[model samples]
Target: MDKSLNTEQVSVEPQEKRAAKPVDRPFLAMLGMLIGGFVGMLSETSLNIALPSLIAELHVSIGTMQWLVTGYMLVIGIVLPMSSLLQRIFSTRSLILFALCDFIVGAVISAVAPNFAILLIGRMIQGIATGLILPLMFTVATLIFPPYKLGAAMGMIGLVIMFAPAVGPTLAGMILGLLSWHWIFWLFIPFLVVAFILAAKFLPNVGDISKPKIDWLSIILSAIGFGGLVAGVNLASDSGWGSPAVIGTLVVSLLVLAWYIRRQLASKTPILNFRVFKKSQFTTGSILVMLDFAIILSSMYLLPMFWQNGLAIPVALTGIVMLPGGIVNAIVSAVAGRFSDTISTKLLTTLGFGITIVGLILLLLASSTSPMWYVILAHIVIMMGVPLAMSPAQTFGLGALDQQTSGDGSTIMNTFQQIIGAMATAIATSLLAFGSSAAGNVSHRIAFTNGVHVGLWFTLIVAIAALLLSLTIKGQKWA
Candidate 1:
């Protein structure tokens, strides 16, 4: 073996001493993670494309169809925090199998459903499965790979996760154009099957199974609290912020969250180790990540709409235009992850946000008649910066914890990303909804511009928040 490979194996040996067998190839493990991550993200993005078809087929209103989007996101957001416990209790094999089964069942149900409500039920089921799979991918990848190689591995996977979904609409559009929307659901089954077989055959069966007993109360409290919080945020996007329904949900969510915190602090075997926040790097890193994701994801969700609806481009062309940005961002994210081990995450993260802010500023100057290349260039800059920021920020965030607690920390970071994505979705959707109605005074072109202007400003605000938070990250290297 090469000396470097030998050194890595030697370092990993102690960590895997308890395993029945060493993982066959860490790269293979990463491939499985990449597949799972790709599929999980694709499920959401493809469904957005397929939604119009489903609505026409089922005779549902747009408002009812909105639930399909909200329901899936809400479930995933709520269940992500519970993944820490799942990682502790279930072996990688069992968890992967469980999540795979969940995706299959939900996909089948949605495919065959007679009504919108039934399809939603299936979507909720699928969301939970996806929720579990998301963090598990990171946990398994982290466990199998040495720290030094984690960034490259995670970056590659992150690229697939981020860019694969950009192709979702194209794929879904092709499928919808050729066959029924049900084929979109059918499309996922084969991928899930492959992921399942690979996971069962090659994935390790390890976990943080040291806890003596499960803490049921903590699980319930966390679920309800996070669920209510996401729901309140989602409701606010559709309804007014001051609405009774939103206020009531927010209040209940806060109360439940408080109780959950108290319970975790007091419990003998807590689901997550809240004490990890003591590390200043971890604290600041998490906030930076949350804000970064909120801005980036919201922009991703909103931009294609501007192109398709505002700019009069076809959906296929929109997907094609968006592809460059997605691929660029994904590549940058992986490169930044590798560089993070040597450079300061603070610098990389700040640079990432700075680039993104410039992109948004450029985007603000755009009109419906603006050249497509300008829009593409704006996104490319943002994408370039993201790679600099995302992986390194995550590595820094999770690196704060001791090895034994890194799993918990990883769960927190993933959960935070999911929540930010969910919250951003709610906020962006609400802004679009409200802005469309409020822009009646402007000409159609200017009205479209105004809506995007408002939304981009929100994204800019999120980017600035991320930039400010990035300043707090310690200039430290992690092995």
Candidate 2:
């Protein structure tokens, strides 16, 4: 039996015609996308380590260092909706090729950047490129592989994409330990070159959609809405939530978002069809995805800081501490993906979140005087919950849509992922900073502990909310 298609009989000829050529190298093609994922995620964390050096060299304030991150996030959030439009306009083959070139250019600019401003420009370009690359890769995988194969293919994709963050600190630590910060940006040049080579060799010219005409007004509105929303979240974290800058930007964001929706509803050729939300499964699945990211991303930000500041470990050691958890999460993702086909998603997602909360509670009990085993056990338990939760949540969402609509649905889900990540990170970081400031003369240990406690409790609440939502999601088996 062909492992690619469903057991239930369907017309094989159209599938064969649409299928990748006999010569198509699926794994090798997958490697190229994995490399893109690695580059995108590595760049994100690597820069965090490089920021202090960046500030020291460029003589910028703490405020300014944020642009290196915030600007990249803004561009990513803004360009994400365009990904589905691009796919509808251009084939996955062409879009991936073009996105790689954009990424390479952004990388080169950053590699040679002499000042902070140039670096910001380069980072923004790279973010937009990443926005295009990630969901496009998922869309392509769904298109090329048979439905049965999608689970494993998507599982592999999940490993590379999600593990990048969990493991980024370790890799960045090693790089920062051995070389200057500049090497981080320069490193991707070679990978981008390799990705280009693979694209020319094994990637097929699969579809014939031309570039979609730009909707400038919608684009402008989306940019304003997403940008203001993210900026408001960040500002609210640092500045008081009541501050004019924070409140005003949030208000503007809400208004623009409303306007963007109206535009989509009115236009025949909207940037992203708001109609996707009308589907009950898609809408519910999207909410679960958003909540999942909000939890995972904020936890990523908080965990590393816990190891580094709370325990007073070096960056390298922090990564070492997290190594087991990252490895466990990777190992479980494939299994979770397979299991999702057989079991109820609600049970798995609830179990996953509940386990994570338990882990967090254990971690909360941790102190510098705690035994190494205790710390390791707590971290491992937390990490174990991720694959258990994420795999089912993601598969259930995408599975709800048919192939024609999958591209658009996948892009929307990923866009929300990035948006939630940025918001959660900003909020968590701000809370940590504020917590530390408020606890003056307290030992760094105590201050950090307080921050982690607050953050973890907040996440716990979020998880409980997600669990409740997951219970309401009607599971549909795709594989």
Candidate 3:
């Protein structure tokens, strides 16, 4: 079906044509979005520590269980490009309420899931909610808060974005220790209910709803293109890269994505505006952001496995190990947002990548016998760099855009994050498998460490590339 409404269905009042009043209660509205977003992001990494448990209990391979992470991100990648169109078609309040409901339903399905397939279905459902809520959080912030206050609002959002992932492992670790993994799903229900009530009671309709013709072909292409690409990468770890399933899907995904980009460039009301790339700073910022997410996700995915499986650390201890770094990441992200006001994006991003590289190098030193303290320190260092780079790079990129296209800019940025994250996690998993297999006679612990080192080396290279790209990020004055 066409995703747009018929003319008769769209009642556009003159008042609707005017801009919305900055929200009547910005804090309440922001609070609801933040809480919902925290739940969504917490779900993202919560499974990292639980992967080993799920694999054994569900009789799945590591590659198969990783889907709990990869599948969630893949769904988000597909849904994010459509968020701008969704925002135009629905009021902010209506959308947030629906997303919350969607999440609650998904959580229920996940908590009671009987099999791996059923659990995955539930995760994807939750991903759909996340895809809607994440972009809307920013879109509503821009709509309700004036420019001066925008920085602080975004910093708060960044705090949730960074902190949630940071804390997810620890939280999941703690929960699994005391209760079943099912409680992880149940634990968030109360918070989700609170967020839903707050949103229903307080969220203002912040944006005008307009009837934009949806591109059915674009939607299909996006779904197949991104889904096929991520699926192909994910399967590569199981089937070799040259396997027909892998090569065929990757080739098809690339061609479809090319066609999709061309269609977007030619359309007047594209679902995701490709024109935003015409801005040099936005382009550079987009690349840095994508690489930054890839690095963060890859590390997050690999580290827990390394600790739990490779080093034989208990799940709870592994989570405790990462706790300090998560806290550090959250604090640094907030401070980095403030620093962006006084610092150049170039300087901040450069330093961020530089620190990330050091963190990766330290991670490379981890082996079966390495001290736990060293691993913790390395995680903390890498976590510090991400916020230092991410907050400013994101701000500068979207800041470079005119107010008219900032929503599109946010969609593109968030879309790439999930897409790249899916790819990164897939590739890291593949590397882990490949490295482990190549180790031949080594013990599984050493073999896994071998794979982790390979993955870390690859992430280190991406960070260096991001560092180089950060150097090219010209000031906004030039834009």
- Candidate of highest TM-score: 3
Residue-by-residue lDDT tens digits, candidate 2, 129-184: 88888887777777777666666767776676667666666666667667766677
Q: Model 2: residues >4 Å from true position, as ranges?
A: 1-23, 49-64, 112-115, 208-213, 368-373, 475-479
- Alpha-carbon RMSD of each model: 4.0, 4.1, 7.6
As a TM-score, model 3 comes out at 0.94
Candidate 2: 10-residue stretch with minimal lDDT: 14-23
Per-residue lDDT over 15-57 for candidate 3, one digit per residue giving the tens place of the 0 to 100 score:
4333335556788877888999999989989999999999999
Better of 1 and 3 by TM-score: 3
Alpha carbon lDDT of each predicted model: 0.74, 0.75, 0.87
Mind sharing the TM-score for model 1? Answer: 0.89
TM-score of each: 0.89, 0.89, 0.94
Cα error, candidate 2, residue 404 (Å): 2.1
The candidate, 2 or 3, that scores higher on TM-score is: 3
**Candidate 1: 10-residue stretch with minimal lDDT:** 13-22
> Model 1's lDDT to the true fold?
0.74
Clashing pairs in 3: none
